[model samples]
Target chain A: MRVLGVDPGLTRCGVGVVEGVPGRPCTLVAYYVVYTDPADELPLRLLHLDTELTRLVAEHRPESVAVERVFSQHNVRTVMGTAQASAVAVLAGARAGLPVQTYTPSEVKAAITGSGQADKAQMMAMVTRLLRLAEPPRPADAADALALAICHIWRGGTRARIAAAADAVRQRTAASRTGARPGAPGRPGPKRQGGTR
Target chain B: MRVLGVDPGLTRCGVGVVEGVPGRPCTLVAYYVVYTDPADELPLRLLHLDTELTRLVAEHRPESVAVERVFSQHNVRTVMGTAQASAVAVLAGARAGLPVQTYTPSEVKAAITGSGQADKAQMMAMVTRLLRLAEPPRPADAADALALAICHIWRGGTRARIAAAADAVRQRTAASRTGARPGAPGRPGPKRQGGTR
Candidate 1:
């Protein structure tokens, strides 16, 4: 499965594409960055993000899109702007029908190394090593995006798929018995549709 | 002398007024908190700030207004929003004809306590003791605003005031030289008529 990792921003968005597989190392297929001019209007910057992300998704055909969760408190002003930028990234992923996942910085650092407080330089080095790229990621944003992708791969997303499959089987068994979704303990189960009538 | 400190934000602004002889001691003259609904459009929020700040200036009649300096990482998404908020606060003070001074968080902390890394609660405690307020400033933002005011009071706002005065003098001289009033800097630097003639 191909994965698209995004480090979202209003001005600069870092994008990385990697070939992901459960229980196997993923390969970094390609990466590119998009920058919105600072002089651009706020809404236009968001539009630029949407347009570029749409192109990236179509071009890379990634099966999943991963983004970093918002952390406000760096600065209130900044946090608000980030909220807008992240919203655009979310919308783009949904439009592309790619499953989207968000990882916190701490979670990504923990996944890359054992420490949650790993600095950007450390995280970048780990990402370079993990992806085995011929060259270290050029810009900080690209390395950050790659780190986000690696985090999702390790953070139980793979197990969630198995759990979802198991849940489907359980639901099928329960429906066969009741002809509908299982009812609460005290309730008389969902009433029989045609047969009761 | 009376000092008014402002913790400016797009959605909320916390203002504190302190009055007394700078060397002898100071008293908490008044304090305020205004919250603008973030859901409002950006321009409306800015207009709201203008009205509320004008009201604060009128009611408190502060001789000086101390504002927080925006210091964030060079992240464009964060800095742009902060710059806008800071600009609004600066204009508010200038419009009121009150000398405006700004200090970074560390500057405030260093002035209050002996350390720059002092936490919010520690700063508030010191501010309460300094102003001899009947109660500790309630909200953290209120405490921060008061701290800024206290910083300016302890260290004469000489640095900022001098800079502003110099800027004013420069502008006036240039305007007289060109025989025209002007606007922001990006516009043609006051005409070159006086120099050529």
Candidate 2:
């Protein structure tokens, strides 16, 4: 699956695209930052960010989008801007008819470095190693975006598998409750359906 | 001036439009709430808000837009959503080429009740009285939105006057520094431009 990850902010928003499935090496498509002037009014800044994000979604055409979930526990001054930026990103993806998911900072760190408490340097190193890039991505925000995309690619696959398994179990349980053989013609017992989730 | 006030939220967004000048009784153009199902995903909720806000701006054609500024000091669990909704509200106004201004809760209260610490009941009372409504607007959110609009109309007028005064002072200062009469020939001595703020 191709995923676009967004590390949202007002001054600088990071976006990265990657393609892969679980247990497979993801290929980097692109990474960039959207910058807004601090001196500008809030509405103008938000509008610019939204315009850029919408354009990027149209250009990249990622199957799904992942955004960094913002928390108020962070810097009180900057948390609101982060949340606003993430909202624009999610809206862009959803408006394009794509599924949007948000991952916490710790989740991204754990997915990239195998530890939720991993330091930035460790996460950067792993991202570089995984993408087979000759050098680390510049402007930590861009690296963070790439990490989020990779994490989503991996975790999304796992979630889909878990959901499919649950569905199968549910079907079997229903068949047993009905006291009919699975897919029986007389009872029209529940049958296994393909995963569409 | 026609002003649109937005009290943004993910579940219920309040909006109101008022028409009047500063120090005059403002006329209520309309007031309503846009609601999104809490069960809906974040992206969908935000998109719905953006759509409704955009449509409202187009329909009302307000000269300016006012939104309640979200603060992180509020309930931590809901602050992020509030910030996101406010962002969408601001974007809607800005996208339509309207000037968008944000007033804090205290600022709105003070403008309405002459006290920053005014309670909700007082605010609703003032809103009903100012608009000459038969009764208080239904849904506290709707009342809050109308209050915000009234505040903007009054405060915005004050702000414009202050800006104009400052501009005049600046022009005089420039004239003295240049050793030329204001608006004189050759020097162009900083003509007194009409307020466009």
Say which candidate scores most in TM-score: 2
Compose the digit string of candidate 2's lDDT tens values, residues A91-186. Answer: 889889999999999999988888999998998899898888999998999999999999999999888888878788877776675775545546
**Candidate 1: tens digits of C-alpha lDDT, residues B133-178:** 7679978778888888888887774454666677777777766655
Candidate 2: tens digits of C-alpha lDDT, residues B1-197: 99999999889999999998998789999999999998988988999999999999999999999999998788888989999999999999988999999999999999999999999999999999999999999999999999999999999899878887888887777667567554454564455553445
Estimate the overall C-alpha local distance difference test score of candidate 2.
0.91
Top candidate, metric lDDT:
2
Name the lDDT value of residue A160 in candidate 2. Answer: 80
Shift in Å, residue B75, candidate 1: 22
For all the candidates, what are their Cα RMSDs to the real structure?
13.1, 4.2
Off by over 4 Å in 1: A161-197, B1-197
TM-score of 2: 0.87
Candidates 1 onward: DockQ, in order: 0.03, 0.78
Docking class of 2: medium
Candidate 1 chain A, which ten residues in sequence have the lowest lDDT sum? A188-197
